[model samples]
Target: MDWQQILTNVAGEIIAPTTAAYALAAIGLNVHFGMTGLLNFGQAGFMLLGAYGYAIASIAGWPVWAAVLVALACAVVFALILGIPTLKLRGDYLAIVTIAAAEIIRMIGRSTSMTEVTGGNAGLAGDGFKGSFQELSPLPDGNFAIGPWSYSMNLSNSWWVRIVGWALVALACFLVWRWMNSPWGRVLKGIREDEDAVRSLGKNVYAYKMQALVLGGAIGAIAGIVYALPRAVQPDSMGRPMTFYVWTILLLGGAATVFGPVLGSILLWTTLMLVKTVLRDVIPATVLRSEQIEMLGWVLVGVTLMLLVIFRPQGILGDRKELAIDVR
Candidate 1:
């Protein structure tokens, strides 16, 4: 096995734009599940909408800022549509609704009828939308290497994307930290602990829930935009599986903790990259095909996650008390 190459790949994953995108998504989910005890199984829907919104608006001649605003607006609309009628339902019911809603979005995006608008299954080419964002990069154009990693400073998947993606993550972490300590965050915690007690205290529980949903959804949309920065906006890529992955990342890092999502994202991607790289190098192709190797890597990762959940349900930084929820 080329151990140096494996190390390089793993190291690159630590700061990849994809990692930052997942981190942002997990942090958004943290706001919903960890802080407010809301069960949102459709975060992927938020992300998909954001990606589509940005792509469509950009294609329609909107400026970058306008496209971004359109993405956030789409998220807000989706949250309202989901939260208005279902926030009062049981958590499990909400989860079902959310997952279904997300699937609906993916199906719609992939439907042949919407091909002209959304590019259907093919999706919009990244080149069309990424230019606006790339043009905003202040980094000098050249091969910039940090240790084992090197790439264009201003092109797609470049340092500029990494910087912006991680900067958003840092800003998100700071905001979450600040919010969790404020009076509003205290009320969210109260709702998480006991809805009846909070409701009796005259808190507008519904309003707060709606607000949390919108905030988290907007963040998820931002994640989708980030994820699309280096690639096309394929609807299938942000389906139910995406939501599950975000959930896994959130839980792995420690839900309710300020930095749990970021920590979890870093660990999960690096670990996956390391496992895949080592397996590909050490195992011969005749023994295992590339796709099989990929599956095997996920199997190993899944087993590890199962063990972590079995032994430490509270996750790496989460408290058991914070995760306690009365689904009823």
Candidate 2:
């Protein structure tokens, strides 16, 4: 086994655009499941909305700013629509509603009826939409390398995307930190702990929940756009599995903490990359096919999550008292 190559691959994942995208997504989910205690299982719906909105608008001759605005608007509208009636529901009901809504979104995006606009199952081609985002890059046309990793300055999956994506992550973290420390943040924590108690204090629990939903959904939407910058916006690819992965990152990192999502994103991606790379190098193809290795990587991820939950339910940075996992 080429351990050096495997380690380099793992290191590369630490700063990959997809890793940053997942980090941002997990941060958004942290706002929902961590700070607000909302059982939002359909975050993928928000992501899909953002990706589709941005891609569709860009393809229709809009600038990058307008495209992004449209994407954020889609997330806000989706949040309002999803939160209105369902916000009143509790526990399992809310979870079921959210996950179902996400599935509905994916199905609709992939349905033949929306073929012209959404590109159906094929989705919008990355080349068609990525151009606008790439055009905004001010970097000179060249490759830039730091340490053992390098990428184009302006092309797809280039330094520009990494810079912007991680910038967004940093900005999101700062906002979350600010929000988590203010008076509004206290109310959110109260709601997370006990809505009835917060309501007794004359706070509008539903309104607070809706605000949280909209804010988180907007961030999730940005994450979706970031995720799609390098790749095409395929509805199926951004469906339930993406949401689950975001959830896993959040729980793994320690929700309700500022850097937990970022930490979890890095760890999860690096670990997965390392596992898969190692398996491909060490395991003979006669014993396990390429497809089997891919599946085994995920299985290993699941087992690792299980072990983390059993040993440290509050996650790496989460205090048991602030743990969102066992929320009421």
Candidate 3:
């Protein structure tokens, strides 16, 4: 096994744009599940809408800013549509509805009729929407390296994407930290603890729930946009597995903590890369195919999640007290 290559790949994934995207999405999930005790299982739906919204807007000649606005608007609309009815319900009902809604959104995106607008199953290519983003790159157009691991800053147009995407992730994390410490944030915590108590204290629980939904959905939407920065907007990419991965990140990092999601993203992606690298190097080409390596990585993730839930349901940084939920 090439230990240097494995280390490099793990390091690269730790700082990759996709890691930041998942971090942002998981943070949003933290707000819903950890802070407000809302069961939002359709985070992928929010991401899908954001990706398609941006893609469709660009295709329709809208500016980047306008496209972003449209995506945010779509997130708000989706939140309201999902939250209005199910947010009032309790427990697994919300989960069931949200998951169903997400799958429905994915199917619609993959449908043939929406192909012209959404690019259908083939996915939508960026029509120069990334140009303005690329123009902001400060690094020179060449490969740069610290040691055994090196990468071309200009290769595949991803340098700029990583730059912008990480910036957005940082900004989102800062905003979430600030929001969680505010008075409004206190109310959210209270609602999580007991909505009835909050209602008795004269707070509008429903409004707060709706607001949480909207905010969390908007963050997820941003994640969707960042996730699509390195590739085309594909419906399959926004499927159930994406949502599950975000949840794993949320749970692994310690949900209620400000930095939990980001830390979780880094750790999870690093593990995946390390696994793939080690397996590829050690497992002979004749013994196991590359596809088998991919499957093994996922199996590791599943096992990790199961262990976390059973042994440390509170997550790495999570408080056991904060995890008190009346799902009954």
Candidate 4:
């Protein structure tokens, strides 16, 4: 086993754009499930909207700013459409609706009728769309080494994505922290603890829930754009597993905490990559094939999550008292 390679893979994953994208989505989930006590299982739907919206707009000849604005707008509209009909119901209803909605969106992306626009299952590409965006690169076009790892500013540079992804994460965290610290945020916490009590206090519980949904959805949409920018916007990328991964990231970091999502994403990706790499190298091919080794790595992840739930349900950054897994 090449331990050095494993170490590098693990370390690099800590700040990788993929991790950042998950962190972004998890941050939104933290708002819904963690702080606001909303069961939003369709966050992947929001990501899908963002990815396709941006891709479609860019492909249709819209500029970078316009495409981004269109993506965010689509997310807000989606939240409104979902929240208006379901926020008044119980948490379980919202959960069912969200999960179903996410699946529906994915199916739409895969639909043959929409193939010309959405690219069907193959998804859309932003080949010429990112030219303007790349033109604003601050770094010179070349590969630069950072200790053990190296990065480049070529046309396909991930450096741009990393810069944008982490920047968005930081911005989202700052905004969330600010909101959660204010009186409105306190009301959200109250709603999370007991919506009836918040209602008694003359607060419009439904309005608060709707607001949280829209905010979280917008953030999730941004995460989708981040994920899609690396390559094409594939329907499979925003499936149920992606939603579960976002939930895992939130749970791992400590749901409801300001920086929990970011920390959790870094931890989960690093651990997954490291373990997968090591297991592949250490396990003999005769006993278990490479595919089996990959599956085992995921099994290990599931076990780890189960352990966390049993021993420390509050998660790494969560407090025992603040644990509100029940979205009542």
Off by over 4 Å in 2: 324-328
Local accuracy of candidate 4 as per-residue lDDT tens digits, 10-50: 99997687898999999999989888999899999999999
The segments of candidate 3 whose C-alpha lies over 4 angstroms from its true place after superposition are: 136-143, 146-157, 325-328
lDDT of 2: 0.92
RMSD from true fold, candidate 2: 1.4
Model 3 residue 190 CA deviation in Å: 0.9
Which lDDT tens digits does candidate 2 get at residues 103-215?
Answer: 99999999999999999999999999998888888899999999878899999889999999999999999999999999999899999988999999999999999999999
Q: Model 1: per-residue lDDT, tens digit, 16-72?
A: 999999999999999999999899999999999999999899888788899999999
In model 2, the clashing pairs are none
Supply the TM-score for candidate 4.
0.96
- What are the per-model numbers of colliding residue pairs? 0, 0, 0, 0
- Model 2, poorest ten-residue lDDT window? 319-328
Residue 215 miss distance in model 4 (angstroms): 0.3
Off by over 4 Å in 4: 126-128, 324-328
Root mean square deviation (Cα) for candidate 3:
2.1
Candidate 3 structure quality by residue, lDDT tens digits, 1-328: 6677678778988778899889989988888987899988899999999988887886777777888999899999999988888889878988999999999999999999998888789889754455544545687888777565566674433666677778888888888889889999989999988899999999999999999999999989989888887777999999999999999999898988888999899999999888878888888889889999889888987798889878888788887778772323
